[model samples]
Target: MKIKTCLIQDSPVFFDKDKTLDKVEQLTKKYAQQGCELIVFPESFIPGYPRGFSFGATIGSRTDEGRKLYSEFYKNSIDIESDDIKKLEKLSRSEQVYLVIGVTEKQQVNGSLYCSMLYISPSNGLLGVHRKIKPTGTERIVWGEADGESLVTFHTEIGKLGGLICWENLMPLARMAMYKKGVEIYIAPTADSRKEWTATMQHIALEGRCFVLGCNQFFTKSMYPEKYRSLVADQPENMCPGGSVIVSPMGKIIAGPLFGEAGALVAELNLEEIGLSKLDFDVIGHYARNDIFDFNVAKQPEMVKENPTPKR
Candidate 1:
């Protein structure tokens, strides 16, 4: 089957929940009208990514006010089973399109948040939600750690749909896990706008022999609060340059580098391309020599701490 996918590269409202959702809805509706079967959006598309602070600030810098803002943002974030996600679920069914969206997902119990991706099928409903295995640097202070249970690939009608958030794409073991699961169409919803990131995506497409849809957003210094203006003063032109792209199984750029604006890049993917691309360098297929160079990945051991009684 031929898979028609579109990547929506738009600037999400900075810490504004309702407005961001409105924008996403409008864009999704537009893409749906274009006969796009699957649409991929950028990381933390809802209530925007905590771009400045989450990327490069100390935990102490998160003042009471900042914490309150984050708490509000967290509260604004959609629950996995919330009505907002259900709306998107219904939209998928109505539009008869598969939707892969990135959002700041709030955990129900502890109320800790995670950078998450939700895979909603047109026919099958909510398929899977994968939290970023490890938040990049300062992001750990804002978002909670993801559990071991989230690494997965959802079997969809289009293909084996799977993804990892932002910098998690750099993690070797994480990529290998997805590769082993036989991910056909890998959706990379990232915030990285560097030229090198594009090269990395291209490499993965060739290495994994899977189509890579690399989606990023476009943001200016003005999009952020005035207090953080000095932080982004150096790179004025392409702060979060919209380099949303789609690479073929052969590591060829089929759709974009849709830079400097909010737009969508549509590409027609033929699954037959995979068979030809895998002819020479299939990571798990003909090219792999497990016995010759086997590398083991170590899992983190569970910690056991004793509870201490309070002194009277």
Candidate 2:
């Protein structure tokens, strides 16, 4: 299968919920017009990744303004069934492409927040969501840990599609799990724009022998609110200079590595790459010794025992 895939490396409307939705719609149409069969956006692209700021959190402490900021964040989070998701669903249907978008999800259980990836298929509307199983560093203060069930891969006509956010890709067990699921096109949505991150992506492509699509946000100081600007004022001119790229099954740069730019990095993907690469090393197939190694995942992804749902 020769399919065109695009990784969107663009800035969000920085906490302006309405503008972000509009941006999603506009970008979907643009990529569709360009004949992309699937589009991937950076993690937390919806309300923008709350990077370069701690949200006033420290050891067992949170400021009043931090609490207030958290409140606004929850308000902006996508309510699974809300118009925010509906609009994106409708756009996917019209655009006729698969979309894997990162979002901050507000749960009905207690209105707790989670960093998530919403998978929308043109043929199936909203297929499912993959919440980040573990939030990184300060992220734990803001986002809830996900159920193991959210660690999943959804099969589609185009390929076995799935994604991980930022440091999740660095988790060896997590990567192995995706490989075990037979992920052909690995989508990595992250806020890490460091040059070393690119090396990690390349290693994953070689390790899995699957195409790796890395999507990161592109932004500068002006892209944020004036108040927030001071938070990242010390950050270089390119606060989150994008590192969007697509590496083939052979670990070769197929396209992109766009930095300091905002646009879709498009590439043509060949299904044959998977087959050819697997001939050398199929981690889950002829190369595996399942008899020696086994995973301890639940029959179904169960809720985390360590991090219970937050109290309302």
For residues 1-312, could you state the per-residue lDDT of candidate 1 as single tens digits? 798899988888777777887787788888889989999989998877766654334644645656666777787797887788788888888887888888999989887899999888776677778888899987887788675567767666688888688899998888887787778999999999887888889988998999999999888778886765665566564578878889988999998887778778998999889988887888987888987867443442222121222346
Runs in model 1 with CA error above 4 Å? 54-62, 225-238, 293-312
Q: What TM-score, over all chains together, does every model reach?
A: 0.88, 0.93
* Candidates' RMSD to native: 9.1, 6.4
**lDDT score for residue 23 of model 1:** 82
Task: Assess candidate 2 and give its TM-score to the true structure.
Answer: 0.93
The digit string of per-residue lDDT tens for model 2 on 1-312 reads 888999999998988778898999899899899899999989999898888777789998889988888888888888887888788888998998889998888998787999999888876778788889899998998899886688878777788877688999999988887887778889999999888888888899988889999999998878888878877777777788888989988889888788878888899999888999988788888888889988665543322122221457
Displacement of the residue 15 alpha carbon in candidate 1, Å? 2.2
lDDT of 1 at 279: 77
